[model samples]
Target: MKTDPERFILENTSVLSPPHVPEIRLHLASEVHDLWLKTEEDLEEIGLPPPFWAFAWAGGQGLARYILDHPETVEGKRVLDFASGSGLVAIAAAKAGAVEVLAADIDPWARTAVRLNAALNDADLAFTDDDLIGRSVDFDVVLAGDVFYDSDFARALVEWFVNLAESGCLVLVGDPGRSYRPTAHLDPLATYEVPVTRALEDSEVKKTTVWKFRQ
Candidate 1:
């Protein structure tokens, strides 16, 4: 069955709430799309804490904005959007002229969202929910956005990314100053002041940084 992207967003919108609900508007190439994220009141209705989908992080938004600004980074490159949520980064890569873009996530809902968003933008993306453990693929670049919230997961992901970088694949991480960000073997590439709603607990606005893994 085909996934309804708008319905998925609507159903998951109440999972977590931010302090202020902002209508996020982003352009996929010449096409523009908008979605209203949940506010704190919405979380109360769903009975869940913040970071419900890890979709509200500023890092993803920053990465999407970066792709829109610098199309050359993805042009002609084979890209992978790791832990893709809402598929924003994957869509941006595809719109920016990536030869091949894959959106990989453990959550089935996230993969569904990727397919839906790709269709909405009139782009094609490879979606997968395969376990990445001990799996390796050669690609020009791997893009990760806001995947450092949890310590265990962050450690595992960083180790995996570092291994990929060592094998000559460029890995970029878009982080919102998460505590679990690895300090070593990482080089800061760019920083952006992302306008973020307080979706996570006690966070107001996040000034995210984009770092490249140094081999």
Candidate 2:
């Protein structure tokens, strides 16, 4: 790794609130400190992943809004935020009074980002860098935001989320019409026209949906 995760994140991002969920603030990349301009080759050269943690995605913003608006969804429950980019949803769960909140992401940079964000929000959260796919879920609720972008990951995640739902855990996901989201396995809960950066998405507003995993 060419740059330290903590140092890079601290230097490259500014704290800001996402458009859809302004109640929570996150460290996000802006035009002044853009990570999006960096190509995959540049990232590979630096031993970094795609830097997904550097922005507030539409799906995550919608999910965080839902959780904040409906505190009962997480209050006193054990919750896991899977693929927790920027720790937005996980911090929301923690603020909503979840007894325990775990933010899991495979990237070391993501782990560093989540930790710092949690600290910034004064929220208690646990973090794991291990890939938790196919593992038994210990939490009462599982939340995933914008995790269906990758085909391979979406396939594995769908099966695991279904199994978790069947096992009596309440599983929820937020997605913005990703190609791999398993519609057959989801029950629609709410939809939001989430505002996002055009630099990252095709439009400035994305129609994102929150769904419950059907058992």
Candidate with maximal TM-score? 2
Worst 10 residues of 2 by lDDT: 32-41
TM-score of each: 0.77, 0.93
Look at candidate 1 and tell me the lDDT of residue 99.
Answer: 96
In model 2, what is the error at residue 70, expressed in angstroms?
0.9
Residue-level lDDT tens digits of model 2 in 1-215: 45677887887789998888887778888862247445233355544445788888888988998899889999999999999989999999999999999999987578989988988899999999888999997999999999998899899999999999999999989999999999999999899999998878899999999999999
Off by over 4 Å in 2: 32-49
Q: State candidate 2's TM-score.
A: 0.93
Relative to the unseen true structure, what is the C-alpha lDDT of residue 35 in candidate 1, on a scale of 0 to 100? 24
Model 1, range 1-215, lDDT digits (tens) per residue? Answer: 23354464555444332222122322111111112224234323443333223354577777776776778888999999988876778877888899999888876356655665667577778988887745698689899888888899888987888899999988888888888989686898778777565434355567778888988
Residue 146, model 2: lDDT of 93
lDDT of each: 0.68, 0.88
lDDT of 2: 0.88
Cand. 1 TM to true fold: 0.77
Instruction: Compare the candidates by lDDT and give the number of the best one.
Output: 2
What does the lDDT read for residue 52 in candidate 2?
80
